[model samples]
Target: MQESRLRWYGHIRRRPPDYDSNLALHLSLPSHRSRGRPKTRWKDVVLNDMSEC
Candidate 1:
């Protein structure tokens, strides 16, 4: 009985947990070290030039 239990333990140890868990720092590192904020284009900012008569 002890031998059988030891075999099961060895088998489980060989296989890791099914749930996937990655380091948060590894995933967010790219965004954290990215360039400055994107600039707004002239076309994106609309101006109101019409005056009421």
Candidate 2:
């Protein structure tokens, strides 16, 4: 699981800056959360794996 996430992360990193998946990682949405705990996002998962290394 971690391996695949890392693979895709590298794949996205190699894309042009304007590519959607690449850009999505850095883009923040204008909307606010409804309430309760925030979701576990894709970047959050990748970051957790990276920190474990």
* The best candidate in terms of TM-score: 2
Over the full model, what C-alpha lDDT does candidate 1 score relative to the true structure? 0.37
lDDT per residue as tens, model 2, 1-53? 99999999999999999988888999898887879989899999999999998
Inter-residue clash pairs, candidate 2: none
Clashes of each: 0, 0
- Stretches of candidate 1 exceeding 4 Å from the true structure: 19-53
For residues 1-53, could you state the per-residue lDDT of candidate 1 as single tens digits? 44554454445546655523222212332354447975553222221111111
lDDT of 2 at 17: 97
State the weakest 10-residue window (summed lDDT) of model 2. Answer: 28-37
Q: Which stretches of candidate 2 lie over 4 Å from their true place?
A: none
